[model samples]
Target: MIAVLIILVSCCCFIFSTWYTMYKNRNLPPGPTPLPLIGNLLNIERGALVNSLMTLWKQFGPVYTLYFGSKPVIVICGYEAFKEALVDQNDAFGARGETPALDPFAKSRRIIFTNGERWKLMRTFTFKTLKDFGFGKKSFEGKIQEETRCVMEELRRSQGQPMNPARCFSYAFVNVLCSVIFGERFEYSDKRFSKLIGIVDDIFHTMCSIWGQEKNDPSSPFTSENLLYVLHSLFMGASDTVSTTLRHALLIFLKYPDAEDKVREEIDRVIGRDRLPRMDDRLNMPYTQAVMHEVQRFSDIAPLNGPHMVTKDVQFRGYFIPKGTNIYPLLCTVHRDPTQFATPYKFNPNHFLDEKGQFKRNDAWMPFSAGKRMCPGEYMARMEFFIALTTILQNFTLSSEKEFTEDEVAPKLAGFLNFPIQYELSFIPR
Candidate 1:
């Protein structure tokens, strides 16, 4: 009789606590009611995180709240909502929010995870260093051109036999970044380099994102640990985006051979078989540009994007989001916005092509994200993708033994990043 009374009292306390918590946060945007501890966990489907968030967007509209445990995360979706929060109201939403899965590991030391003053200093110093190293400029093309030559030779050795190009793509892309960071590039045969890449791969299979320095102050952000973490962030970011995009691009190319043929045709017409493609050449190659934009749009690489925090209390679309509230500016919604893309789900290059077949920009094509927290490597990544892909088409025809179905060609739309299914293809020399 005493044990039963204790259990009954515990249940009553739990009920009261939950009710009080819900009532306190009643002003937050409406969505599915959350449980006491594991708030909204049941609402999310297993192994389909991006899709689940998107479904919530449809149900609750663009701006709504979901609970992760007791903490409320304000999810901002669609192009208009994103623009308002990230661009227009940039300062309020500029701060980095807690990524609980990554918080322990990151410790807010790296540029990618920190907020306020430390973030500004890290970002400023890192961008200046990256610029000095020729990140987004024309001078950086030399490194890419040299890497492209090496990649082509590696492909030639494949002898038209089917092979997974993921490793080769990784080596080439990472080497360019390594050149910037370490002032050197590792050989493809370097065992230590390969092992290090493997470790980074394991971490990505596990969570993912980066930099800098003041002087000898105790409060300075320039410690050896900080520097190491910054390099770690750069390596992870550098290796992932271009390589993953290339993998998806190749898969899409195989799925649409006509698109591949057009890319090759344009390459031959403009760049010719004798020379490598240049950034200047991108201007005249409208179809190739359209294809690259479409690839990024359809691939939707970083779907959830990084979590952001509100620096101050703000009103958004008739919702009251408190200061320090975590925000999810869903990139998947922006890229897949039906109002923005003519065929949001399909791999249609025409979304970026005008009536005259010239390349046109879509405001919603935000694969790198937007505003103050926008990717620092946007310009470099754009150049890399353009040059690397144009170079590939300039030399080889992408061919696969197994034909990809429409579903296979579509983005997986799951997890932190969307990766294409593992498949082999031949780099049949043009």
Candidate 2:
């Protein structure tokens, strides 16, 4: 009886401490009450981060707070909140938050995760280097198209069989940057290139393991450790995101063959089958562009988005956000904002199209995010999208081994990325 009494007393104290923390942060945007130790973990199920926050959005308004294992984060839902925080108050909300999941890959030094002076320097240098290397230019697009020609031979080897195309897609995209970064693109079967591909295959895990081993080493471009980090950043930026997006595009094509037909129709009409699709061809092929945009919107890619930290203690949307607090812009919310898209839930290319059938851009469509930390690979990714998808569709008509079902095309947001489930594709030569 005495032991039971002590247990109850301990529980009461834990509850009191939790309540005190909330009391101190009473001015924070309202959210579900957090429990001690677990915080709001029980409130949010794993793999359903976006849907769970979206449910709370209905009750808590666009901007609200939620605790993940005692770390309170301000969740910005919808376009207005995202614009207000990330755009209007860019500096105050500019710092990149330390993400425990990506700290291994980010190292708090690379362009993706670093904040303030480091972020500014890395971003500036990266942009300059990319521009120098012809990113977003016809030269870069031509380079990507060259790589695409190489992969097309590999895809043809499948001979209408159900095989995974992710490896070839990844190799092509990585090699495109390999030439720009390493000054020489490797053959697909080269031993050194193959090993490099292996490392990038599971890059997030690889970097997580190798993150700090280079810390004591001198800071120079020639350092082997630093070289690895640069390669890792490039792979993270180029390979995985683009490969996953292209793979998703194929899955979408299989699921909605009519969408595929529309893309092919647009491609054949403008570029024709004789020549490979080019970035210059986008203006004449609005339907293909819209379909590609829709594929990305439907994929949701980096759903939660990389976390951003508050640069200074500031009040936003009538809530007091302390400096250094983590902020998740909930970009998936804006991407699926009903007010922004006519059919937010469906995989409709019309969302990115205007009445006249030209590809129209939407403010809420931030697949690569916005503001200070927007993806540096946005232009390259776009080029790859047009080139890679058009090339694949140009040579092959994709179909799934199994019948198309909603569960098949729908994303399994089990972990960090919003990607489709693994399904084989029959890349039938067109």
Candidate 3:
């Protein structure tokens, strides 16, 4: 009789445990069935997270929930849902989710991850500092012109020889940021600056590894396990992503020479062949603006911007999302959403141009994201990319070694940021 009682009690405990889990998750958003304790561990395939999340969006609608070791992750794929959470409820969704790896690095300092009062203070300071350095003014235009001259001199030194433009582009981009932040610039030959740039690249590649996946020998200089992570993030976040986009832009231009010709023609007509294009010319040069927008859209960098954390418990469409819930903003999904774009797959600049050929603003074209935490250096980055791209095209013509096609330039997912496989091209002087 005692043995029978023990077995019955054990069965009751098991039933209760199962019921408790169901009760806890009863009001959570819909998702694939999660196993007890392990949650959805078995459902997640390795190294295909972005693809898997996209598939989940199709199955679970715009908003869905997934569990990672008992932690709830809220995935927002649809633009409307994302807008509702990130924009409408901006204050609630402003906090970045905790990553064990990034925690040590961004313990407090950097603007990207730090939240609350710290984030507000840093963000405000960064914007003011950027403006002081000519981010949206004529002073900034002079700096870009100077940088363009430096690039022209460097390219001229190539003497029409086949040389990779990555290094030069990286230097110009980084220098622009350095001038704005550190109040200085570095020569291309400066070894310390080169090392700093290398460290930045390393951090970017390391962060690209999926969360929880560890690399780097803890002792290595490139290892971004601590304070270095913040530095690495700032540099890599600003430099590599922009540089890779520019590289892809050049490659795409060579592949689509007709588009290239049109852009150059527009530049010539607006700014003329005598002087390099300026930031002011961005408005007057509609074709060039369209091409710039198209490059950003087609590149699709930072598919998933790490993860966001809810600062306070909130209700969304009758679902209660507790504070500290991880939120994944599917940027790629929004950029390619058919509901928002006409031809989500094609590389047409017409997406940004209206019937009259004027640059048209699309709410969906959010490469740098929207709301409070949008990229702080967006204005500076945009001006740099435009000035560098148009100036290069204005001075020279680009072509590949062989009949390289756009389809051939497949994007290799570099962690979160997508980059094209290395390819060669020639910059012929026009």
Candidate 4:
């Protein structure tokens, strides 16, 4: 009898809390019913987070809300609506939101998570520093060129054997980024480098973004904690993304040898085999530029962009969004939007090239996101992708060791980043 009474009381409390939570945010955008604690998490299909979100767009229209626990998360779909929230109406929607899954991981102190004046200060400092550190400049390209040679040398050691290129790519990109962050690069065999990587993984699961520093700046927010998280993000940002894109680019080239041949031809024609590819060479080689853009487009990394929140309570297209509502601009939908690309589902390089064979601009091709809150590392990452890819094609022709069906390379999206499944290839010397 006592046990039954306890169960009944617990049920009543759960009911009341769920009701009170729903009543408070009644004006927020609508979507599926959220459970008492888990919210719409269970509703998301397993291993298909990106696809499931896209499917929900069909039912919910351009914008709607889902829940993470009791917190309301607004999902924005399509190019125009996604751009409006991220690009145009950025003041209200630009702030980063802390979800239960990501909040515990991101310390709410780093540039990727913090908001308002804090974000502004860190962003300004970081961007200025990155620019000063040679981002988008020829000097940065020189570093990438040096790393490209190192990776090519590693590939040459493979001697035409079927090799999984992920490690080689990771080693090269990580060192390049580490040099940018720490003023030097580490050899693959360095024990200290391995330990530093372990630190990055440890920080990822914990939100303790602090390491107390005795000195202070009233106007500055660069705490040791902030610096650590920044370092963590640099390593995290550097570790997988650029490497994955390069991997995907190689995979696509393997799948489409004709396209690979075109890139090699462009490299040979514009820069010659004797010289390394330069960022300036991109202007003269439209097809190579098209290939690079298409790889990003096709890879569709970060399908749901980093979670953003409203900085303040605002009126948005017939909805009243309370301050602190989590927002996800569906980038996968943007990349695959029929309106944005001619053959959105197919791997076509012409999406970035005009009939005159010039590299045409597309505002919708936003892999790094946009607006005041746009990724500070955008230019650096793009430059790395361009220089690394072109140089690789310049030195080697990638061929699949084992034939794969179209569906084989189509790996399911995991977390935020998406790319082809791991496969082996021969880096045949050109």
Candidate 5:
């Protein structure tokens, strides 16, 4: 009787382990083999999630899965997979992945990182508020114009000397958001605003630190974490990405002086030498618009839109994705997929221009992402980049301060965001 009881328990344990293993591996997308308990966590870098995933896509097919400590993460690569997941089944993938660290910080409020009804409410409110402020309005153009004037003044004060445009551009960009959300502009030297920016900067720096960990110890304000996450996403999304793209734009122009001359010719013919290019003239400037699109495509910032989680069990293409599976949309794979973009690796403005020489929209061009969880600040970002780039280009001829080549200005991966290594440039007044 004792031997029979022991045998029965041993059999039951073996069966349970086998069932669990099968359940975890069954009907999932193809990916790197995960260990029995560790999953793919060991394969991934501590902080460089995007780079690691992109490398995986090169090995695995476009659509693959990864595991984060037994948690399944679906990585959608190439344009087709990204479109299908983000657009076709938008509602199914609307939920954001909950992280132990982010939960305490977010409290699940704010538009950038919330889900469900809260996401809907925050998005709608933000959209309406932005529309009321200046999006799609005549006054909106005026606000951008005002900000451009300030940027131009600062550039002019540089006296055609080499200077870091990052600070000036960031201040102007943040002020644009401030004008709409906070309803005021901050002085460049304001202590409080400066501190806020510093805090935001720290959050970004911390996010990229692999050794950093979030502590939920007592005596910490909830608002501090909340503000940190919000400002981190904002600064990371807005400042580093756009500034890097603009830096690349300058490098591209210098490398191809003919294109630069053509852009200047277009601006000269459309707006003339005395006045700066205005938002209203965007329609008439096909080359400039094409250049902007190419810059976005070539830079391919934010290759993956962070991680998203499955809220319910889902089955697709003969695969069963259980509840709580995480999904990562690989925007870089989509943007650079040979199947989608012609000569995907080449920097070509014609990709965004039609035979008629007018601006054309490409469905495959999804720098801001797509679907229910697409970038809420898409319109605002476009406006900022357009106003900032065209405004600066219209007034100045940009080139490297030293004899820096395009290869020298190429971006080195900095966490998820790719930025041009520290390089200086001269913005000689046109």
Candidate 6:
């Protein structure tokens, strides 16, 4: 009898606490009412995180709050809200938010998850080091070209037989990253490398290197532990994000053979069969450029984007967001904003093409995201997208045994990382 009374009192206290907290945050941007313990967990449909958030965007308007447990997360959707928060008020919204799953392990140590002076110092060091090692410049072109050749050779060995290119794409992307950070590239067959890749894949389902050898200053952020975390950030970006994007690009081309043909035609005209596609050739190949941009927009990988935090309390879009409040700057909403794109849902390269058939920039198309938290590796990723896809098209035509529907080729829209459907493709030599 005493135990039952205690349990009843405990339940009452919990309900009161939850309601009081909600009442306190009443001035925050409004959304659906959250339950006591779970907050709005029931509001989200299982296996459709991006869709769920987007649906809320329509119902609650652009800037609104969604509770994850008792905590209020300010979700900024659409291109306008994104620009206003992430760009116009970047500093206030610049702090890294808690990635609950990663926080215990990462401990806000990595470049991607850290905030304040640590992030600034890490970014400066990494950018300079990677630049010195020729990441974003023409000097690095040879490394990418060589890695693409390795991929081409591997595909040729497939002998036009259908195979899942995911593993091959993973190897190529990791090798390019490994080469720069570790000063060595692993063969696709290397057992250790294969194991490492496998571990990375598993973690994405849930959630590199030695450049700091010369730093002697103990006060500097370039400690061995910090360097490892930096490498962790770089590896995670390359292994999953870049490789998944490549998979999406190939799958999209398979779905639209006509689009693939046009890219090939451009490749033949400027890049030709004699050599691997050069970054210089991108200027002359507008169609290819448009297609690459379209693929990114359509894929919408990292849709929710890495969570951010408000550094200080501020008014945005007529709502008050408190300091350290979690923020979800939805990249998915921006890429698919109807106001921004003519046909946002469909995979149309014309979203990036002008009347003159030249590639045009759309600020809404921010796969690397925008503002202070934008990807430091943007230049390298862009180079990979262009050079890798061009090289593949230059060497072979992509085809699939299974005819994928538009939905099949579309972004999975389920998890943190958007993945293309698992399908096999035959790379017929051109």
TM-score of each: 0.95, 0.90, 0.86, 0.90, 0.84, 0.94
> Can you tell me which runs of candidate 5 are displaced by over 4 Å?
1-24, 45-51, 99-109, 209-241, 404-407
The CA lDDT of each predicted structure is: 0.86, 0.80, 0.75, 0.79, 0.71, 0.86
lDDT of 5: 0.71
Judge candidate 4 against the unseen true structure and give its global Cα lDDT, from 0 to 1.
0.79
Error of 6 at 337 (Å): 0.7
Worst 10 residues of 6 by lDDT: 205-214
Against the true structure, whose TM-score is highest?
Answer: 1
lDDT of 2 at 122: 54
* lDDT, residue 243, candidate 6: 83
TM-score quality measure for candidate 3: 0.86
List clashing residue pairs in candidate 2.
none
Candidate 1, superposed: residue stretches over 4 Å from native = 23-25, 107-109, 208-214
The per-residue C-alpha lDDT of model 1 at residue 416 equals 75
* Model 4: residues with Cα > 4 Å off, grouped in runs: 1-17, 20-25, 35-37, 198-214, 217-219
* Superposition error at 234 for model 2 (Å): 1.3
What tens digits encode model 6's per-residue C-alpha lDDT throughout 80-155?
Answer: 9999999998999888889877765564347888789978988988888787777876758888898999999999
Q: Single out the weakest 10-residue window by summed lDDT for candidate 4.
A: 205-214
Global Cα lDDT for candidate 1 = 0.86
Sorted on TM-score, best first, the list reads 1, 6, 2, 4, 3, 5
Encode model 1's per-residue lDDT on 1-430: one tens digit a residue: 9999999999989977975685465578888888777888999999888888899999999998888878889999999999999999999999998887876667533788888898897788678777778877776888889888999999999999999998998888889888766788888999988988887777766764122334567776666667777667777776778999999999999999999999989999998988888999989999999999999989999999999999998989888888999999999999989999888889999999999999999889899899999998888888889888988888888887798899988867444788888899998887
How many Å off is the CA of 181 in candidate 4?
4.4
Per-residue lDDT tens digits for candidate 3, residues 294-325, read 88887887778657889888898788888888
Clashes of 2: 0
Q: Please list the residue runs of candidate 2 whose C-alpha ends up more than 4 Å from where it truly belongs after superposition.
A: 1-11, 205-228
Tell me the number of clashing residue pairs for each predicted model.
1, 0, 1, 0, 0, 1
